[model samples]
Target: ANTVQVQVILDRSVPDRTALDIYSRPESGGDWTHHATAVLVSDGAEPGGARPSWPPRDADALDVDDVYEALTAAGLHYGPAFRGLRAAWRRGNELFAEVALPEDRHDEAGRFGIHPALLDAAVHLPAWAGLAEVPEGRNRLPFAWSGVRLHASGATHLRVHVVLGEAGSLSLQATDPSGTPVVSIDTLSARLVSSEQLKPAGRGVGDALFRVDWQPLELGPVNRESWAVLGDHGLAEALRGTGVSVSHYPDLTTLTGAVQAGEPTPDLIVLPITTHTGTEAGSGSQQAAQDPG
Candidate 1:
């Protein structure tokens, strides 16, 4: 039957800890079988080490698109807002990355130290796990966690550090945009489970797992007579060929000032987004932008 039973074992000697086991039957008239056990502890969690430096100077910058493509090939799908892995780097046994929650997910950020989806992005960093050899085609689940501590809450963007453990585990630490500690995990253990365990006997485990929910965006055309762009000299020069008027501003602040002083305001504004692309300390950045209209 799909209905399962939960049993908890508590010790009077140690009231702060409890053991839990779940039992389910394979068929309507089958034997009751133990499915899972989890032990809950109310103590022993401690804050982790100091925050590491941001943008590791020696790590090789990884192609963010390549990283996501590899994960998708491995059957790990991420939705639009969930694809928050902006950039990544690797330096031997250590991995670092930049992650952010989309503006749409910011409303729910206060509900968690780090939104579950954002924390999940951190897990994908292990896709760069080249410091050691990994087994092939093994499906492992992280069922146990230890030394988890939350330093701060409501972070939208983070700089993450992941150190592969000597054994097959993960140690994670995350900080906010300004390098304030946000969360730390000492060790998260992943135990291998056989395919038989996943299928069980009667239950369709796939029904209980999560799937990518993709919402289609409704796009429409826009008509603008004037355009304003800042920071990118190349784009401004290109727009000069178009018959429409193009105004170039030195920066966003200057653009705002012209609009406030009764100067002509363009129908649409274009701004440049700076992104770090190299492992060097003072490397330059490339620009990306969406349709401003």
Candidate 2:
């Protein structure tokens, strides 16, 4: 494409919080593809917080070589830069790992809170963590991440703590050598995928990934008698300009409270939302992620 638009929109509701995503069409006439999504927030706690001592005294040491080999056999091949899982130990369902980027990459760590290679390595430790009880050969793929916070930037070596949660979720807390938190993930959810589903595409036309075609919707004129807009009022102003009278409210809770307090009820309520694509909706937990670098 000759030109593409990349937008960065900030959340005015929350200070120092933002969400970023990109969508670009392959050609000028093709539909846009969602490249990626990531959020940055300041709600996370700072480093030097309370945590267990470096490596727990009672946990048995795991052979790093065997661990890497097992990962390869499972089809997760780690390159040298990503081979950061130096030592790991498991005490019950929890896992502790020591991860670091190669020495050459250490100097580049100052720009971010744990390099992506090292962070990816730290999260993979949970696979060998004896986490779930399922049949053999089941593939687990991470889909969504929630409550991710990067506490500090520039840490090559990190001590990580991972706790398995619920049925298919886990949490990660990585700290610097002195125990200052670098990055924390409240929940990293993964779903069990079948081996047949994990197989490479292009085996035949029947196994190919589906292409998306967007259709224009025919929107009818407004049919509401009275309306109320919740949260942001920018949309409400637009509707007003179009001759649609909309009562603005800070949020739904307050709007309902007013109705309960004898205020006139609205015939319609409006808010902004973004829905996932058809592929994203249909794939659900079955989406196959690319191989680990």
Candidate 3:
């Protein structure tokens, strides 16, 4: 018999906190086995605890200047959106790193609540571990993550600790300048892949296949007669020539209506208009039409 079962539930009654219990059983209606427990925790490190210490004592420094270059060589671009490596150090199997967003993005730190770029930089130290001998040309990328926790929010500068875990995995912890814990990750894994696999697929933006349904907006009685001529312009055929397969609906009001009426709602809902009669060059209508939304 394929006998395996697991159940998890949140424990209520804990004020401002959450606890989860996971249970497993070999067979149905058999005794339930308590497999594990998960609890919410916080580090409570002050806002600026990281700034004062200045790269903990006795740790060998790792070159921070060539961080992005090394990553790009390994097929990881470390693109501008996620570039935040400032400095790094290593002591034994433990690694410490400093990461900060560019000066212009400082104001967006709080709004984003622990930006992905900073978090990526924090885990990026391990890739720098064996810089000189990281194979000839294999690319590496993050494979998995587990037990991730965000204790607090808004950190422009961060201190990250990466410790060796079982089976070559890494455990990561990130803190703010004052040493206040911001996030903890139980496990982070990376996989090396061939450089050929890292290349981008040769698909252009226009090559995308999308189901689009045309709907006419309510233009009121004034434009109703004029809008009738707009619908017969063979707009769907023109869209087909541009590589989009669209379904035309002459009388659909809203996207939701198609779903409720057992019709396949298209990936895109296009509302056509005859003309912009009273709109100025820089008006909201022109701006909205220009936007790719």
Candidate 4:
């Protein structure tokens, strides 16, 4: 874990006929290991080249609905903002996908070169092709992205081609509708994890969207004679907090008569009752019913 070595050896010197031989080893005292060797070849309009026929000739269409349903059942649900995959198909180890963000998300994609949601959707195509090497009760989550290159930006719609690899790893190339490269990853690996591990913590019901604004109730200009209240310290303090005049009445009958007569009658009345938790207060709605008028 402390060190890594990567050596590239050129197999050929010719400009168009160059080849690369890669050797890698860990710093933890390991022998030199040959990783990958590639021969650089000119890409033409052919299979396995830079440009290929759309959708591949023999790819089988996958059931997009079933893929989502299965993922949701595994607790891998994608919200509206992240659901970008439109359709997908597979041929052999190759996966093809069509992905498009909602029109409203175009501006965000423009600012951030192919929205991460869309990019993530593109990578998930292999999972839809049943390429995930996850064990039972387990799901695969993205672990790393290597050799990633963003060639262009401002693409809301994309076509993705993926080559599934061993152990839940894959390589993907994405392009805009015009066949301009949007992004490409030489290697994308996913880590196997239990569904429980992927489950997010429960969110508060009213974090920001639902909130209580505790504004002082506006009852009005003070009318000392117009306010009659009967309760313990709790009710007295509540009314006094609003800057309203509070007159304590000994009996409910006297309070009721004064309120119904409508002359020198208190416009607001309060009656306090003890709560189960030993608090000396009833809810605002309950006190509202105790108003004499």
Per-model lDDT = 0.71, 0.72, 0.67, 0.71
What TM-score should be assigned to candidate 1?
A: 0.51
lDDT tens digits by residue: candidate 2, 38-124: 777666355444778768767777676676666555555567888888888877768889988999988888776568887888877
- Among these predicted structures, which one has the highest lDDT? 2
TM-scores for candidates 1 onward, in order: 0.51, 0.58, 0.51, 0.51
- Write one digit per residue (lDDT tens) for candidate 4, span 200-289: 432342222244569898788753544666756567667778977777766678777766777455666666644454455644234343
Ranking the candidates on TM-score from highest down gives: 2, 1, 4, 3
lDDT of 1 at 110: 96
lDDT of 4 at 218: 75
lDDT of candidate model 1 versus the reference: 0.71
TM-score for predicted model 2 compared with the true structure: 0.58
Task: Name the Cα RMSD for model 3.
Answer: 26.4
Pairs clashing in candidate 1?
none
Give the poorly placed runs of model 3, Cα more than 4 Å off.
1-54, 130-134, 166-168, 202-293
Clashes of 2: 1
CA displacement after TM-score superposition, residue 286 of candidate 3 (Å): 91
